[model samples]
Target: MKIVTWNINGIRTFKSGIKKILDSFEADIICVQETKVTRDLLEESTAIVDGYNSYFSFSRGRSGYSGVATYCKDRATPFLAEEGLTGLLITHEEAVGCYGDQLEFSSEELLALDNEGRAVITQHHFTGADAPQTLSVINVYCPRADPDKPERKQYKLQFYKLLQSRAEAILRSGSHVIVLGDVNTSHRPIDHCDPEDVDNFEDNPARKWLDHFLSGALENGDTEDQFGNISQKSASGGKFVDSFRHFHPKRSDAFTCWSTMTGARQTNYGTRIDYIFSNRFLVENVFSGVDIMPEVEGSDHCPVWAQLSCTLLPSPKFPPLCTRHMPEFIGRQLKLSGFFVKVSEKQNILKGYKESLPGSQEAGEIRENMNPVVQGNNIIKKRPADKEAETKAHKAKKSKLTKTETKPQNNLLAFFKPKQTQLNPPSPELNPDPGSESSACLTNAILADDTHCNSTQTKSSDVALDTCVSVVTETKNQDKQDKETAPVEMCRKGPCSSFWKEVLRGPPQPPLCKSHNEPCVLRTVKKAGPNLGRQFFVCARPQGHASNPQARCNFFTWVDKGK
Candidate 1:
């Protein structure tokens, strides 16, 4: 039985990645964190993926917030789904704390934990190879200690403490348990990118949380070591195993989660936070291997999987339709032009969602209905690949040239240069100019006369870059002159408010920072050409954003003129 845990960030955003993983791993159960799904979507059958029996816990406080879900194989039905930790009433009071204090779950006081859909435990009774066994599979997405929200840190600590208590109680009842998901806390310095950059040891709650949770038993009966630390063993005697760390014990520079920025993943600057933990019996008997799949695209955090050495039941014949949302990969690009295709598709999906909810949870495959936008005569595919391979290849070329060299070698006029080769220029038909027949004819004539476009050609740095920029510039001019138009007011009024600041922050925001250490912002600029004097967006990144590129985020987007 293979179980996988991934903070998919938003399940709908990378529904394709989920399908890809399900196809590959054939996991018996897949647990996801930060599902960010609301009750409306869940009840509407939009989020239901057909094959596995899925159970979702949604945030009760807000519409879309922290949510956790566990999908179990059809054959291995869950015995019970404990959404609210029974007998634990949790609420925020002024004196007690924001996350609430733990008192006896007695008759007078109720156990109402935060119903923000943070954790969900699905119990399954199965006939094991040895004997009949029942496993309480708990999937938790622990709260992060966000700097903006200090109280959340306290909430996280409380959640961690409650989780341990819950695990202890479950174990005391003689039931096997496997608690796994994003703990959202780096256990040690080795688990993070740079330990020195972190807050002081005395002030860091994460370190304190780990020490208290791992060192000594929280329960009364357990013995404390000489230093009064609880061994990393859970109250139920399942030594909390960081499966990845356990296997790659001394491994460094290995991370499961990376920053959303582009170079972060490429450079492999990341932290190991997501984990799979289980009791002694489950660990020793069922544990086979742990794999961190960094290659998987869709979420900022990669999926962490563990192989349980047991026979998995045959999967269902047809998988169900996963919920559709704006692709997260779309946010990875800084270009405004990059947003058009996805933004269009997202609007369509949102419109299509108005259909009446399905009467029953019948089995059916959901073929996402995403229509592509036609720009002039150019027809682009609706769905684009992550393009990670291309990015990696480019980086690899830079790496090869920079070998054993200092930072100065990164300059184009340095000791090394990219090997020049003959290449065919882009075809004239690449820009059909569907709106203007005259524009198309003129472009074709230019291509016919130009030697570069007339035949397969090799281009010098100046000629190539200039031609590329000209093509883009001309294309925008043609688009601006076309019937498809953008709101002039939107472009003229640059982002000012906090809302606009976040909205204008381009995807894959400039990796480096501006002169004042401020992150670069995407801003609009007016173009001067033979065509319409339309405004387009560009990365207002400073020179320092990238070591080489003048603009860190070479993003471009014409203002939307059309409704």
Candidate 2:
């Protein structure tokens, strides 16, 4: 199994094109840092790669900032995936839950450390001759400490301490751990291109921490002072081994990151801040080789991969989080057209619209045709003569009904009228007030063109007729009002469903998509173009191949094109 790690800078830079580049890498598991996207801004192409199962962690405090993602091939998918070093961020039931003794840091501290969306942990089983062994891969994008910000320096150091605690906790939980990503700190002068120019480089706090964090096999190159005394190290030994340096310790200028603004990468003037650290036992036994791919050119930091000799054990009990099985991607793999296309009434037996048509076959006849009985020699078919005879009989019956139907409208109205006994004429003295509500209702119903009374009723006085007509008028008006006020059912199935609901409520809705008739989702332009930071709208459906039934259509419209 080949496991690769890279800080892609900004994942949305690829957007819909990321999938093709991901497929080109051909790694079993690829962990990317600096995704710079929130959960809301996630695109279909990035979330649901064709053959990979992905887990993502987004910054809760910021948008288009620090984030990380892990993509595992379908065959190499993990049984469990968790986000953040803190136990607070473990969303999945299957997790590396043994977060032993973090009494040093308060609950608020733990939450603050993980709020930047830095880490994603995935657990897999690696099988060999013996019983299957479990391994945890913690992918992290460590915080970069700015020299100007003293508080940031403390935060970065705290992150490292929290990270170390989590790794040790996982180790104690019986799972071998592989911690990898951009450490953002060069451990020694050999790892940095221009280490000699910097004053007091060895005194850097992060480098000092790395010296003690890595296994004792790597030498701590402490310079001798003028008094000929060696500086004492912080710790005697460390828990993890740097995989790349383990294989090529003496190899010079083996940098993994560069400054894009200075074009330092062109001159090979950079530092090796990215790493893949594993247990010494795994480095010796399971990992066959570890190397960097400097040729790949999407980000300033290139990818570092390790080849493992062990096979990835599959777990049916806990299936991997593949796009096919995930709630957001399932059924949404189709294009927008697939959802809006009209379905035929004949498709449902309960509708029976086709069977109700004149000269159409009855329900039993249609069922008989569906399952035909075979004769000895000749195949059975509905005779043309019999069909013509049935059509003629249908026409004759229709004509006879038409002749008998003297008052078809009254007959239909009578079905809705309640049965009532004949009433005697109202007394002359018992007269209703013309200005009362019931009197007004009676007047309106009698004057209305659609109102009618049965011939069986006596030629009653106006007062008696007024009571009967008022009840019918109110019932009809109530039914009419209900039909007019009922809300239309909106599409409620998709990743963007909740977003669309909120978008639809307040402002005027965006123009409906031509293909799906769905209100397009709003987006902003962040790339280097003429329309940078410009807002626009596109289909809200999940992205997929054009052939897919639920994939979004190519509907593009700028929110303010003139601007």
Write down the TM-score of every candidate: 0.50, 0.56
| CA lDDT for candidate 1 | 0.59
lDDT of 1 by residue, 246-277 (tens): 45655676677877733466656678888887
Assess each prediction's global lDDT (C-alpha) against the native. 0.59, 0.75
Candidate no. 2 TM-score = 0.56
RMSD of each: 25.5, 23.0
Error of 2 at 168 (Å): 0.9
Model 2 lDDT, full chain set: 0.75
Evaluate residue 496 in candidate 2 and report its C-alpha lDDT on the 0 to 100 scale: 61
Which structure among the candidates has the greatest lDDT? 2
